[model samples]
Target chain A: MAWNLQSDRPIYAQLVEQLRRMIVTGVYPAGSKLPAVRELAVEAAVNPNTMQRALVRLEEEGLLYAQRTSGRYVTEDNEKIMEAKEAMAAELISGFVSDMMRLGYTREQTIRLLEKKREG
Target chain B: MEEYLISCRDLGKSFPGCRALNGINLELPRGRIIGLLGPNGSGKSTFLKLCNGLLTPDRGELLVCGSRPGVESKKHVSYLPERSYLNDWMTVEQMIGFFKDFYADFEEARAYDMLARLAVDPAKRMKTMSKGTKEKVQLILVMSRRAQLYLLDEPIGGVDPAARDFILSTIITNYNPEGSVVISTHLIADVENILDDVIFINSGNIVLCDSVENIRAKQDKSVDMLFREVFRC
Candidate 1:
């Protein structure tokens, strides 16, 4: 999938968000190897160091693991991936709620609208 | 011992009436893409020229690879000036040959590959190709060299958006982690995402130098927007 990034925010943060999406969406399936830092940086048209930082952040969150010599791989832990997906879903829902409220919709109205949209 | 690919200490340069640069202190490490950004007449080009030894600083010093800009430093620097330097009479292939003969680090195969990828006709004279195509050829030659410092001055200044993307990608894919690239341009938004760090210059002085990430974290805005705010007229 094409990585869409914005210049208005820190690229490292964007890289983390995009990579997380990729992981949870199974674009990079569990236990699959990630491209080397340099390779991904080139492909993403970002700094290698920034890309490294994003990967390191993911590793810290237990979404990825590094082998001594071979390189980084997506975590095989299914629960961790699910947790990431749930967190992303929560964030998206919160954003949606805020957007709806800004448009003058009450909380009940917003919920009703979402449920209607889901039904449709 | 060799920490910075390019460093400046009280570096200053001036013409008769205008000071092009003043009291510029900078330290650029290797393996990063740095954006040297400023408006017109902001000393961005002057700093780059000093790095390439095209012009010398009248006061203080600028060094590349721990040595002052000179023949020694020139060997490690691959520069792409804003103007086309290729002899219009020479064909693209011949131009590649000329670079190969002059630069020890120029990679013939890489140049050929880039040329092929750009779909540039090697047999066409430099004068015959469109402006965008000529720019692409020049970029290919410059990037083919495995130099320790790549100084590109307004590399995408006159190119179209498509060509700009190609040039940007070429730089990204061809960059050597053992070296550093300093790209000077006023078009900050177009090049913001690819840069590891950015150095803002204004009125012959170094203004702000920081990593792109740090700038965003602190300022909470894009580099281009921050540049607009900092250098607002």
Candidate 2:
């Protein structure tokens, strides 16, 4: 999938989030090699320096790790990936509940609506 | 010899009607893609022109690669002005040849490679090409140079969204790692993600200059949004 970055947030953060998603979703599978900085920047249409910063941040967070000679790679730690995925799902659900609340629906009503949609 | 790509001390410039730039002082580091942002009649173009040695400041010292804007400094800078300066009769191939012959740092293969990616035929003359194609050709020639600084004036102003992305990609991928680029344009959102730093100017004065991330982090606003709030008429 293409990077669908919003204009409101910091691009570096968006990139890090997107790359993390890519890894968590197995788009870049565990132990898979990530593209070079320039190539990634070209694909995302972002500055290489900005892309490098995002990659470095991801590396620090253990979602990615750098080899001495070869390029970066997705972390092989399945637990860490699972944790990230669960965290993302929690965030998505939280946002959905809050948005539904703003539209005058209680948490119970929101879940009921979800269950009804699934059943239908 | 210079510590910065371009440094100025109390730099100022003017035309017959009014001042274009006033007492601007800043230092641009290498390996950066800086957005020179401002509204119409702002000093963005004038600032870029000073860096390119096309316009001399009226009051203050301006340095490019440590020396004054002259023959030695010109060699280190590649400039793309807002208007086209290509010969109408020159075909795309011939234009590339002219650039290769004119600029010692120009890369023929890179220029051709960019043209190929854009599907621009080398046989098309400048006069026969669309406005967008002509702009792309100019951008290709400018980016093909292995110069120390690239001063681009509104490079994506007239291009389509697809072309704009291609041009921006070309810029980020092809620019020399050791050099700096200053892009002056009104399309803030289009270019914001690609910029490392941004210099916000208004009415001949520099209002802000900082890293793009810092702006978003500190102000909690996008550069485009902050720009509108800052430069609202």
Candidate 3:
């Protein structure tokens, strides 16, 4: 899958967020080996160093683990994945709610609009 | 202290009435992609030329891989000039042959592979190809090398958005992990994602040199936006 990154924020941070989403979404399934740093960097069209930094951050967070000579793999902890998914969902919902509020929609009206869109 | 891939101390260059670079001091390490950014006449091209030994600094010392820019340094530096340097009369295949003959690090098979992937007809003469195709051909030749330092000046300046994306991806894929690529261009947003560090220049002087992460974290703005704020005219 192609990575959609914005230039306005820290690329490393964006990389971490995107990679985390991929993990939670099962795009990179748990316990599966991640691509080599250089390979992923090329695939993402980012510098290898930046990609390395992102991978290291994920590893530190227990979302990924690196074995000597074998490369990195996603954590097999389903609970951790669920936790991350919940956090991401919360962030997205909060952002949506804030945007709707700015547009003069109340909480009930915003929920009604979302429910209507979901039904449609 | 370990040696830098490219370093200059109080470097200055002038042409007739204009100073192209002034009191420039920079040290670039290996394994990084650096963006040298500035507007036209801001000395980005001059700094690149100086690195490639195409032009000498008027004053101060400049070194590539620890030695002065010369025949020895040229061996480790692969340069893509702003203009197309390929012979218009020669076919793309012949151009590959020329590069293979000139640079010991040139990989003919890699060059051909890149050409094929880009769907460029190697049998066609340089003069017959479109402007974008010619630029792709040039970029392929430059990236096919195993040089320690790559100096690309205005690589995406004249190309369309699609071609620009292709060129940037090519650079990312073809770069050697042990080497460094210093790309000089004004299109900050397009290349900012791939750059490990950015050096801002204006009026022939270095204004800022910082990691993209630090810039984003501290300034809370994109490099393109910061560039406008810094070099506002």
Candidate 4:
């Protein structure tokens, strides 16, 4: 997954969101080991402590768990991943719908526009 | 673990008629990347010089590694001065050797490895290498030391974008995990991504000290943008 961080928001929050997307999409599949914190930090070009904080947040969310000396792994619970994926999709759709509404489109019009696009 | 790596209290320094640092009180924790940011003549260099023990405060105390910057603290602090002190006659290898002889923490292998990565030949003399190469070499030498605190003064100020990226990545990968790094630069946008916290120093006074994430979250702006707003003349 790309570590496309921006300067406008907290980096660790971005990392956590991106990592959640990665795990849900099976980029780092269920039970697969994650890279070490320092390695991930270097790849993302962020402070290791920031990266670690993001990972710990993920752990608390039940998306990842660390083993003693063996490093972290994505949760084996596929159902949990599916739930997270659905939640993120809902968030994206809600954002899009609200933005469309602000542009003078109704909720029905927003869905109709998406339906029209899907057929083409 | 109980104390800050570098602590200052009512620290004051004056040069001739100029006040370089005034009533500075701050504490830096361990294992974080901090930006010492300000515009030209903002006393960034003077503050770092005091931390390196190159200049002593005229009033109050500035402590490094729990004590004043001295022979013992120098062992834990690796500094890259803003200016290159490379002898015109010496080769890169000789410089590394000199550092190795001077600092017990210096790692010759690590220095050579970074030099190779930069494609800078160790056998080349200081006079032959370009200014950018000399700066990179100096950075390599400073980072190669396993020192607890790395005080880099305007490290990427003069390099090209590609070289700037290289220098930053080198810093991230090589810094001692138990130590802290305080980078002083006016180039905020370039280093913004890597810094955990930033100290805004201007006219020898600290205007702000906050985490980068906190600033972005609360202020909804990059440190670079905030710096312009705060230090605009």
Candidate 5:
């Protein structure tokens, strides 16, 4: 999962975003057993408490499920995962484009920059 | 499955010139989120420390997890002091390792994973991290344990609005369902919604101890409003 130190958003939300991306990209396949909270905390260099919050949010969103003493696993519904990823990506990009426009970037300039980055 | 996670009888403590806690009695049930609310110099932290074994009571008996405060209680109780207790020289990774060594229930992998998510470098020394970052790191370590009880002293104090939400969500999500957590803080509004039970302390005395639902029903006002009415400072 990507943890952006410079991002204005909270770290737990960023972690959730990364997990969603991974699930949508088929990195952590649907219905797969995810790493334990402790292991994920160590790898992320964060407190287990923060990671636990992210996991709980994901569970609430139906992207993950927990078993008694068995740990969390990716949800079985692949379509739901993809839908959430799409919605989140749209929300993020829209917010960026809106902010750019508000900062005086023309629609053409924004599109051109987006195309340039996509090609690069 | 202990009957009461914490049971105190006529608990009291006093210094030479001041009585910090006087004739205080409290019973905290297992598997509940209890808030210890009080004003400054109200002995809220002192009471919590007493329960966690950081301070000894002058009189009366205290039992945590059905046993007196000692090595066994120390093992079962995880405490986050009001101030920074971590060695300034140690890195985040080193601190995790220290906890792993000291508390057998501490999960190293969990702590590291949380640090990574917060973009906190294990290699960076604690002395360099910002005050808020240090608090976050300490919270991660304390919440990582599978202890029977957690005594968190002002976990949300001095944090930004977003950070407060982060800390609260972490506490709610990480704590064991069967274990009890005693959160000592004056910022009652921040946590009032999530607390299963609220214990209001005034001048070292417990004025009220009841479920959030019961308090709301009885007072007919929100916790924040009640808090203001009670403290009024």
Candidate 6:
């Protein structure tokens, strides 16, 4: 998965986002085993500690699970994966709405634009 | 095992013309990464110094591993100052040798590996390197150890974005997992999420210290936003 350091968000969050994107995009399918922490850290040019943090965060959100000696693996539950995707979508949309409001977009105008964009 | 690795009781410090730190009480447990955040001249550096025994408290007691700072404490603590403390005349190898001499816990091979990753030549003198490069070298040296407590002051403050990433990655990859780290920096947004716990300091007083999850759930705001609201001045 591609990780961008230029984003204004925290690095661990960015790593999480990209890993989630990979799962949704079918790059890392359900029941797949993720890379080792040090290997991923080297790939991302991030610290293994930070990489572990992202992995732990994913584990906390139920997107991934850690096995005793098998390392971190993708969650096998499709329902949970769908729920995580929905939650992420809502959070992203809310963040966008706040940005639009800050940029002086009215609620009515936002609704109209969203409708038009959806139709086209 | 002790519940906390560090415990401070009414810790205070003052400069000739300024009160750097006021009465402060803090408890830091082992295996947790703490982000010590504050604005400029807000006593972040002074607090780190107090814990590292570089600066003595004026009004209270500070404890590390259940004792005051000294030779015994020095063996367990590794620190990286905000400014350059390394002599310019020495090369990277010499610096490694210095650490090996002073700190029995230092791993010279690890230091060389880290430097190699950054393309830092061991034979080059510190004075010959740029500011950012020198800072990276210093960070590599400090992190190449197995100390119990690491106190890093503005570890990423002097570098470019890429260099900052490198420095951060080095920290994550090298430090002992079970040990505690207290990083002092005003750049909260960049490092907020990775922090297991964060202690907000303002004007030498601790305003808040909590886990990232609790802060977000309770305050309904990210740590970065909270920092902006708290330190807007």
Highest TM-score, which number?
4
Per-residue C-alpha lDDT of model 5 across residues B1-233, encoded as one tens digit per residue: 67888999999998788788988888887767788998898898888888877889999989998898888888989999999989999999899889999999999888988788777889999999999999989999998999889989999897777777666666666656678888899887677655767888988888878766566656666666777888896
Residue A17 shift from truth in candidate 4, angstroms? 1.1
Tens-digit lDDT track of model 1 for A1-120: 788887668899999999999999999999999998878877887877788899999999999999999999999999999999999999999998999899999989999988899999
Model 3, residue B106: what's the lDDT?
A: 97
Interface C-alpha root-mean-square deviation, candidates in order? 1.5, 1.0, 1.3, 1.1, 11.6, 5.0
Q: Which 10 consecutive positions of candidate 4 chain B have the poorest summed lDDT?
A: B169-178
Order the candidates by TM-score, highest first — what do you get? Answer: 4, 1, 2, 3, 6, 5
Tens digits of per-residue lDDT for model 5, A2-118 = 544222234465578777777777888999999988567545544455567789999999999999899999999988987988897899889999999999998889999989999
Complex DockQ per candidate: 0.71, 0.75, 0.71, 0.76, 0.03, 0.19
- TM of chain B, each: 0.96, 0.97, 0.96, 0.97, 0.96, 0.95
Candidate 5 lDDT for residue B66: 84
- The C-alpha lDDT values of all candidates are 0.89, 0.90, 0.90, 0.90, 0.81, 0.82
Q: TM-score of chain A for candidate 6?
A: 0.82
Error of 2 at A12 (Å): 1.6
Q: How well is each residue in B86-157 modelled by candidate 2, as lDDT tens digits?
A: 999999899998988888999999999989988899999999989998999999899989999998999998
Error of 5 at B61 (Å): 0.9
- B215 Cα displacement, candidate 6 (Å): 2.7
lDDT of 1 at B119: 85
On a 0 to 1 DockQ scale, where is model 1? Answer: 0.71
Q: Show where candidate 2 strays beyond 4 Å.
A: A100-118
Q: For residue B203, what is the lDDT in candidate 6?
A: 85
The DockQ assigned to candidate 5 is: 0.03
Which parts of model 5 are misplaced by more than 4 Å? A1-120
Q: How far does residue B124 in candidate 4 sit from its true spot (Å)?
A: 0.7
Candidate 4 residue pairs in clash (backbone atoms < 3 Å): none
RMSD, each candidate, Å? Answer: 1.8, 1.8, 2.4, 1.4, 10.3, 5.0
Best candidate according to DockQ: 4
Q: What's the distance in Å from true for residue B168, model 3? A: 1.3
